[model samples]
Target: MSTSLYDADYEALRALLKILRVNAKLTQVQLASAMRVGQSYVSKIERGESFVDVLLFAKWCEACGISPGVALDGLRDQKRPGRAR
Candidate 1:
C-alpha cells in the first residue's frame, strides 16, 4: 500500500506507539537513547513525519518495554474505518 505516516491508519499506529512510550515513562530523548538514535528521529516518528518498517517497529516496541507482537496487534486493530486494506 502506498501510504505515508500522515495517513489515517499510519497516524493511528504512530499514536499507539507514542502512547506505549508514554506509558513506559520514557521521554523522547530516553527512547531515542535506547534506540541509539537522535531525539529528532523519535520526534519525527511520533509526529508522523517519518515511517518505520517492521524491523524498526519491532525494535521501537522493545525499546519502550512493549511486546512487538502486541504492538502490531494494536496497530492492526486500529485500521481506519472506511479505508481500504
Candidate 2:
C-alpha cells in the first residue's frame, strides 16, 4: 500500500497510546502501573496486538495526562461505519 493508505490502516488508537507514552517519558511498566494494568498489557497495546475499549482508552488518556478527546479524535476521523480496510 502507498504511505497514505498505510497510514489509514494504522490503528490510530494504538498510535495515540504510543505517542502519549513517549511524550510522558514513561516506560511500559510505568504506564501499566499508572493504569493499574500489567506491563505486558501496555506492550501488547504498543504492538497493536489488542484493541482497547472506550473505558480503558479513557483511563489510559487520564494516566498519561491527556484528554480523552485528544486520544479519540484520530480514531474517530479514520473509522467509518460498515467499512473494512
How far off is residue 75 in model 1, in Å?
A: 2.2
Q: Write the per-residue lDDT of candidate 2 for residues 1-85, one digit (tens) a residue.
A: 3333125345665776888889988888898999899999888877876667778888888888989997676567557776553
Writing each residue's lDDT as its tens digit, candidate 1 over 5-84 gives 57877887888889999999999999989988899998999887888788878878999888999988777866757755
Model 1: pairs clashing at backbone N, Cα or C within 3 Å: none
Over 4 Å off in model 1, which ranges? 80-85
Best by lDDT: 1
Ten contiguous residues minimizing lDDT sum, candidate 1: 76-85
Off by over 4 Å in 2: 1-10, 74-85
Best-performing candidate as measured by TM-score: 1
Error of 1 at 19 (Å): 0.3
What are the clashing pairs of model 2? none
